[model samples]
Target: MNSLTIALDVMGGDKGPHITINAAILAINKEPRLHLFLCGDKSIITKYLLEHHIREHPQLTIIPTTETVAMDEKPSSALRNKRDSSMRKALDLVEQGKAQACVSAGNTGALFAMAYCVLKTLPGVERPALISALPTHKENKNVFMLDLGANVFCEANILYQFGLMGSVIAEQVDGITKPRVALLNMGEEDIKGSDHIKLAATKLSANKYINYVGFIEGNDIFTNKTDVIVCDGFVGNVALKTCEGVAQLVYRKLDRFLSEHFFARIIGKMLAPALKKLFKSMNPDQYNGASLIGLRGIVVKSHGNASAKAFEAAIFEAIKEVEQQVPEKITIALEQGLIEETHTE
Candidate 1:
């Protein structure tokens, strides 16, 4: 049987090792051919293993690390000061080729910093960006949004590159061949936003390599008008978080309205199954992870508040990314100059 071992950081996150350990166990049970290298305090992991009665799985192994990178701590400090931190150790396993991928629900900034420092970026790529899949109304259709929180400030050329890379990922993962790419702007016209938007649109439209769809407003996101949406990290991150907040508000409102009265409660009971299925399809946790694109290896960033189910989904995402050799494909795209660098001639 082909074996794929993943390095999971157990000591990073708000819940410490609880959610991390449980997620690992859940992933192992879901995929028998999968093995996990748990990096954290050995004693803590061992205790959880014993408590959960998961002591004797040949597929599971634990690697001890003395320190941990905190959520608020800077990545540089964590890397330089905490040599034995679980997050750093996990990346080390990936660097050594001992693991196929690494998953951490821990510090986001630290993970990005560590990944760039260790794995490095592919040739022709400026900086790595975070790409996430957001569900849309169209059946089996999802939009790929990038620079979710990687680089807060990006140049026009960087946004153009993000379009190319985001398009590649959308085609590969979402099966959207000939994906339509768009720049996130306040207006759809050619003349919109600041000098940056105009510059990016001009450059993107001139690129024969990308199917640039001009500009798309934020409201157009749910219309499935475009397959890939590219923007700076600041705007992308705000949009992503706004969507999440809206989803939560809707869920809460629905729950309160449904349980408030006897008639509504009866109606809710009748529609519970269908409503649950619909909500599950739209839940952020169901799509709780983002891929750190442009890196040399496959690295996924899961939600900080991810549950076992969400973490399990992240593992499956990692498996698929590795199986498809996404990094190699990206390298090929970069080498062929499919992504161009803009110059002010």
Candidate 2:
């Protein structure tokens, strides 16, 4: 139980204080040395803390913040106007060294803005990208995709940096000594994609730091063809949401089909366990949450619709990141000039 304090934005997300508070409790229970600084309405947190009989844990602290950055608020305006918001307060904690990391299910854009503005980025990092792990069928192998709505328009060099940063995360977390990297394109051929990707492919292929695996189509994302997939934020976000929508549709269709007939219903019951396991494996919440890589400290963004379990998982994910010293490792890699230009024929 390492003494790692995480500042949590309690007022953020659809679930608000209820799910966030409960998840904090769950994290504290799991790790005794974990201290949580809940930033939100103090009264709300106090009421739940007393009701849950979690009194005087020494590890739990509540910071009073009255305002909250709404999900729909403009990131720039929110950051400029709401100085006392819970999200900003959480980032302040990280900057002040009071917390090792910050966790939020709040406004994605606002969170990213606050992180960059407060904590800043490491040297050689042009922009801090949002990286998340998606479930894959390969055993002990999960796929990582980055620029997930962080930088909508990225340069060729930026995409190459995403690959390098993502590869470091995969190797550290998944134990992949030499993680395979790929450029996300419409086709696998060399002459596919735009000028951005064409230039990126050249740079990634020429760089010796990462194991470049040429180009990968959107369909190959889950086929274990590559360990890390790099693309601009706009494209990556679209791919992520599309996969999520398709998964939900498949589940709904299966449910409807199974109940259409008595025999099918019986078979569904018999196969429920396996199906549940498969679904669980594919769910995004089970893997790493969105990490604000390239920043000085750890900052994780959970799904706005995340449940108590998902929040708990995000806390542990942050813990693993701190324990692994990801930021330090990346800083070393950057200093060594491991991120270089690559060219593909």
Candidate whose TM-score is highest: 2
Point out where model 2 deviates above 4 Å: 285-288, 338-345
How far out, in Å, is residue 134 in model 2?
Answer: 1.5
Show model 1 residue runs off by greater than 4 Å.
273-286, 338-345
Candidate 2 residues 1-345, lDDT tens each?
558899999988878889889999999998988999999988888888888897667878899998989999999998899899999999999899999988998889999988999999988788999988886768767899988888889999888778888888998988888899998999999888899899988887787777999999988989998899999989988898888778778888998999998999999999889776666555564334689899999999888978888888888888989889898888876665453432222
Q: Poorest 10 consecutive residues of model 2 by lDDT? A: 336-345
Candidate with maximal lDDT: 2
Candidate 2 yields a Cα-based lDDT of 0.86
RMSD, candidate 2, Å: 2.2
Candidate 1 residue pairs in clash (backbone atoms < 3 Å): none
User: How much lDDT does each candidate structure score?
Assistant: 0.83, 0.86
